[model samples]
Target: MTGTIENMIVKLTGWLSRHSIDVLRVSLGLVFVAFGTLKYFPGVSPAEALSVATLEKLSLGTVSGYAAQFVIASMEVFIGLTLVTGKLLKTGLVVMTGAMAGFFAPYVLFFTDLFPGAPTLEAQYIFKDIVLAAAAMVIGARALGARLIPAYERQAPVHEIRERVAA
Candidate 1:
């Protein structure tokens, strides 16, 4: 029974290892598209106000209100479409990196608004970006030819191991 369970576990993990990156990429894309679409409508997105405020501040008051929201929405949708199509992914990742910086700027710029002596709802929203950022890193690594090697495939060749030991 133990052997059978172990075999099942291995198979499940193997499947996950093979498909996890693609799944993550597409899921992140969908999330971006959904949230970006929300920003196209006023008062629809929970992050709209904060996002507009952040953009306004970041742009030195040059961009504000609907214009700021439009810029954010357009960028996110572009990233989403690239990720979803698996085309121009490198470009998408590059844009995503910049967008991530903007996304994180609020922590430094609005610490009090987000904290307010305790974690507010906006803080929780921003905190979730940590996960998004991590997921993006994994996807980015995959895009750059990095991969998750299964444990069985991670062992060095015997000769290589022996050579290292001799050295």
Candidate 2:
């Protein structure tokens, strides 16, 4: 029974490893596209105020209000489309990473208000970008020919191992 369970787990892990990248890309793309589109319509997006404020602060008051919100939303849509279509994926990943950094800034820059003691709902939502950004990095790295795992199993040579053991 234990052997059977282990076999099943291995098979499941293999399947997930094969498909996880596409899943990550598509799901993240959908989220970005949806949220970006929401920003275009006034009073539709819950994040407008917070996003605008963050942009304003980051821009030193030179950028603020609806204009900043719209600009950010447009960028999100562009990144989403690129990621979804697998067109210029590297660019999308780079942009998304930067955006995620900006997205996460409020928690640090406005800690007193955003966190106080525990995190606010808005902060919680923004925090999810950390995971998403990491996922994007994985996808991007793989797309650029990263070797996350060796294609074949590897073990140290017997003599090398013996020497180390002896030492």
Could you tell me the TM-score of candidate 1? 0.86
Task: Estimate, for each residue in 1-167, the C-alpha lDDT of model 2 and write its tens digit.
Answer: 87566555555655676778878888889889999999888778887888888989988998888898888899899888987888988888888878887888888778888887888888887888888788788888878887443222135565754453343
Residue lDDT tens for model 1, 6-97: 56665666678899999999999999999999999999999999999999999999999999999999999989988898999999999999
- The runs of at least 3 residues in candidate 2 whose Cα sits more than 4 Å from the true structure, single-residue gaps closed, are 1-15, 147-167
Give the CA lDDT, 0 to 100, for residue 90 in model 2: 85
Which numbered prediction scores highest in lDDT against the true structure?
Answer: 1
Total clashing pairs in model 2: 0
What's the TM for model 2? 0.78
Given candidate 2, what's the lDDT at residue 25? 83
Q: Which stretches of candidate 1 lie over 4 Å from their true place?
A: 1-7, 156-167
